[model samples]
Target: MSDTPELPWPVPDERFRHWAGQFADMHHLVRDLVIPLGLPQAAESVLTTARELIRMSYFRYEFMMIGAGTSIIAIEAALADRYGKGNLAGYLKKAHADGHLTKEQYDLLDSFGRPIRNKYAHGDLTHVALTPPLAIGMLRTAITLLAELHATPSPGPSAGGN
Candidate 1:
């Protein structure tokens, strides 16, 4: 048995696109809806947008890691690196904390959002396949997570400031 977790889904361009779009929609929601409502100052509005973009990009990293982790597992039954398939959540959490990912990365991941992409790519689901509900849930989670990331102020000039 491969030590790595089988991909929850596949890595096809379509599936990738589906995953990506879902997250993209989340960013779009933040930009079109959240920003307008938040009414953030111009200076901060851009940062807010950047924050959302970072969150969105992390999704792509997660998707890629899913593929990379699986591929790593394929190479060896056991994960040679501790940062293997099981550690994706941590990776995302850390990236969110560090603010390393760029808008481009998030855009790339959002591109992977497609229906049944994971099912066919990873061969995880049997007959069920990646359903609309599940994809929506994933998208929701992405949005929630991204929002959470932006909710807190970064440890910078304004972090816990007057």
Candidate 2:
């Protein structure tokens, strides 16, 4: 007999299969998504790690919050990679001002994205809540934004000679 112990809670095969389906759906989402290779390695690692947490969250609800928190951190890391040494709003403002992001993109990020990320980053854990859909949405948004950030060419040295 296998030495493994059963979980205290019931984990029926059917339920496990169902969770597998959810995991597959999440895997497929990330599989089809691609981020630029030019991005800082840390940003890519963070995104991947966040996705793994999201996958695990399907197995356990607690992981969902951790995954959600990591998702926003991944976004922040991507922003830091692109903009460097600044807060979310400042980085986004620079992105918009430089025409790297469209007005709508900026507005979308500024509206809910900033607040959600801040809620986690600033440690508002008691009030923070997350569902799989919302966590997946956050992951998707982070990847999309990271791609956009990397795809945009950084401004070169100023035209005028030093």
Candidate 3:
């Protein structure tokens, strides 16, 4: 038997699977749509566009991570009002401190996700070698973290009217 521990929440495999199919379908649809517009007549242009689309789709995990991080920062900023304008690391730290993320989740983002994202964003391609499994794991973690943070109840006014 395997010794892996059971996960506390469901991993988002179905959504990712569906998204993968949709991404591929999008390429096909784009190709079909452009055929009537005389794009396919320029074989080089069609191939280039298709290849670029596939390459972009392959990095969907990175895009999702960046998007999720941005969303977390936005939510935190909205809650903290004037105090939210800062770097992603600072925002993530604040989220952890505010009980939005657990210690493990925070560490995962701090250690792996954030660094990879930074490297990718800064055009440090040599350091951004992401495998399929790693990308999937990171995507799952990001989704889980975002979902948990969004589900948490916001603090409200005190009952004593202070």
Candidate 4:
């Protein structure tokens, strides 16, 4: 048997996109973003997957939930390579203490532990309807935060994808 657990929802087939090619296609600010030098490959992979899922959310907006939720987990995974252990919350303190993140950045992400991160993780019904703007913003926060935690200041936000 495959080790993968059964998904609660319908399995996505090759034709996952609906009304795709109808528009110019979704874009993400994080697309082609550079991860900090020496960042863990596994972490970078998760982060990419998270962003791609968010971009795909434009086709099926509900995918925003998966994207938003995965972004938090991506942050946590990035932390595992940088810090010792624990989830995003505990690691943020360590990241902050090390001058990896600014107070404002730390505070914003630490605050996400509840209404954003945890709720999505637990499959809260309200969170599934998470808006695209909110989900995209969360991902931006995650990518910037991860970059800071590693090294090299972020290039800073720019106008999002066309």
Q: Output the number of the lDDT-best candidate.
A: 2
Worst 10-residue lDDT window for candidate 1 reads: 71-80
The per-prediction tally of clashing pairs is 23, 0, 0, 0
Indicate which candidate wins on TM-score.
2
TM-score of 3: 0.42
Per-residue lDDT over 1-162 for candidate 1, one digit per residue giving the tens place of the 0 to 100 score:
789887664223444454445554544433432322342254234334434433443344333333322222221211112124444334433443455334443332233332123443576433333333333333333333344444654344344778
In order of appearance, the predictions have TM-scores of: 0.25, 0.64, 0.42, 0.61
Off by over 4 Å in 4: 1-22, 28-38, 125-129, 152-162
What ordering of candidates by TM-score runs from best to worst? 2, 4, 3, 1
Model 4 superposed RMSD (Cα): 10.6
Q: What is candidate 3's lDDT per residue for 1-162, written digit by digit as tens?
A: 779987675333343454455455434422322212222133324333333433344335344444333333333333353233467677678778977667876776677667765665676634454443344344444444444544555444444666
Q: How do all the candidates rank in terms of lDDT, highest first?
A: 2, 4, 3, 1
**Which stretches of model 2 miss by more than 4 angstroms?**
1-31, 34-38, 97-108, 156-162
Clashing residue pairs found in predicted model 3: none
The candidate with the higher lDDT, 1 or 2, is 2
How many clashing residue pairs are found in candidate 1?
23
Residues 1-162 of candidate 4 have per-residue lDDT tens digits of 999998675333223244244323454343544445565677677667877776665555566667777877777777666655577778778778877667866775676533567877777734444555566666776778776666654333344744
